[model samples]
Target: MFDSIQWLIGIIKSIRINDIIDILIVATIIYYLLKFIIGTRGWQILIGLFILLSIWLVAKILHLPTIEWIFDNLWSIGIFILIVVFQPEIRRGLAKLGERGLFRYSLISKKKAIDEIIRAATFLAERKIGALIVFERNIDLENYTEGCVKLNAEISLELLISIFIPQTPLHDGAVIIRDQEVVSARCFLPLTINPNIPKNIGTRHRAGIGISEETDAVALIVSEERGEISLAVDGKLFRDLDPLTLRKKLIEVLEIEKPDFIGKLKNKLFGKKKWKK
Candidate 1:
């Protein structure tokens, strides 16, 4: 016990201020990275990896040569695993990082794109046209875009409206928007696997739930029947939001800016009452 106490004291003494700062910085980066990947399939794979790592450590300590050897081989093939398992996330992370340094160039481009999308959504809402718009942030949707017509065009309200017009070729499918560009139209997204979803929720809503469940993408669904706007994130849906509310919520979820308490207070006092109507 005395020896162990002395060893602990020695280790503690060796840890300098720089070490604490380094640890904090690393921890903060990891926290945000995990936050970005939360609710995605990558999270499950990460959990599995942690379990495997724990087992490997136990095996190493226990002198289990066979188990250690297997883990060593697996570590050697980790590059391939990353390529296959986290392809979408890897692409997105790279895209986000690229955008950071060239903010000025991308700002106007993104603003124009967002404006067109807002216009399109408003038009659909006014006409009671159902639409599903999935906006990519730091994640690629190429795999999800399979079987869909690739537009790869600059986003415009008119184009969005045209695609989702009833009985049109792309009317029944989801549209994927990335970097202020419409990458694809009429793409089929996965349906939610959750059994507890309400029976009344239709296919479009289910698809929104599923896609959000699997990725960090935000789903905007405009109901054709009720003309209600719903936002889905992390596999959960917030229904019956108005245009302004939707925009605010989207900005919040996207982490575009820090929340302003005064603005929030004002909104709570005024916006809620107005929305109640």
Candidate 2:
């Protein structure tokens, strides 16, 4: 017991600040990766992969030559296989990383953007015009904007409502907003493979949820069928939000103070708990 205690002390002493930081960074990455895959089909694939890796490890430890050879061959193609299998997740992670790290805007600008978005969504919802508007936060959405018509115009309630009007050329796809501007319209986003999404939800809703699932972007959907407004964030959908709640929620996301205040309180209470970005 004494020797074990000494060893523990030695191990604790050896852990430097840099080592702690390194461990924290790795832990954060793993945590986010798990969060990314959780509740999706990818989680099942991850479980299978983990089992295979464990079997390989056990076989190597037992000196099983045949099993070792098989696993070695499998590992040779593992990179390609993983890339193909996890393409969506990989794209999402990379998109998250490539964004300008600080997702901030002036208070006045943020309020204006939020008001414009609320106004547009209200207008679209009133007309029962299906609209999918993605508000890019920390995630740069340019990769998903390919083949979209580049507008790069200032946000306007008129333009937003007009874009989603039925029979319009750009009515089918999503509008991508970045830095308080509509950068593109008719942009295609990846469809989520999450099986839990309701079958009754149409492609527009799925795409909204999909883009939100894949990035830090906020997706606002105005359902043509129901004339209801919904918001998707981090793979979860909050359906049938009234204009007041929608405005408040958008402000909560765009404003730094509320998130920062909540984050600081969480850190003080829980210490390094996963705070929303």
TM-score of each: 0.62, 0.58
- Please name the candidate that would achieve the greatest TM-score relative to the true structure: 1
Predict model 2's lDDT versus the native: 0.83
- Write model 2 residue lDDT over 21-66, tens digit each, in one string: 9999999888877765775557778999999999999999999999
In model 1, pairs of residues that clash are: 92-138
Clashing pairs in 2: none
Q: Candidate 1 on 1-277: residue-level lDDT in tens?
A: 9999999999999999999999999998898788668656687788998999999999999999999999999999998997899888778777867756423455345545665776778788888999999987666566798889999777777888999999888898899987667889999999998998888888899999899998889999988888887888888988888677777776666656555899789767777322221
Which 10 consecutive positions of candidate 1 have the poorest summed lDDT?
101-110
lDDT of each: 0.82, 0.83
Candidate 1 Cα outliers beyond 4 Å, as residue runs: 1-52, 69-112, 137-143, 191-202, 210-216, 233-240, 260-277
> Which number leads on lDDT?
2
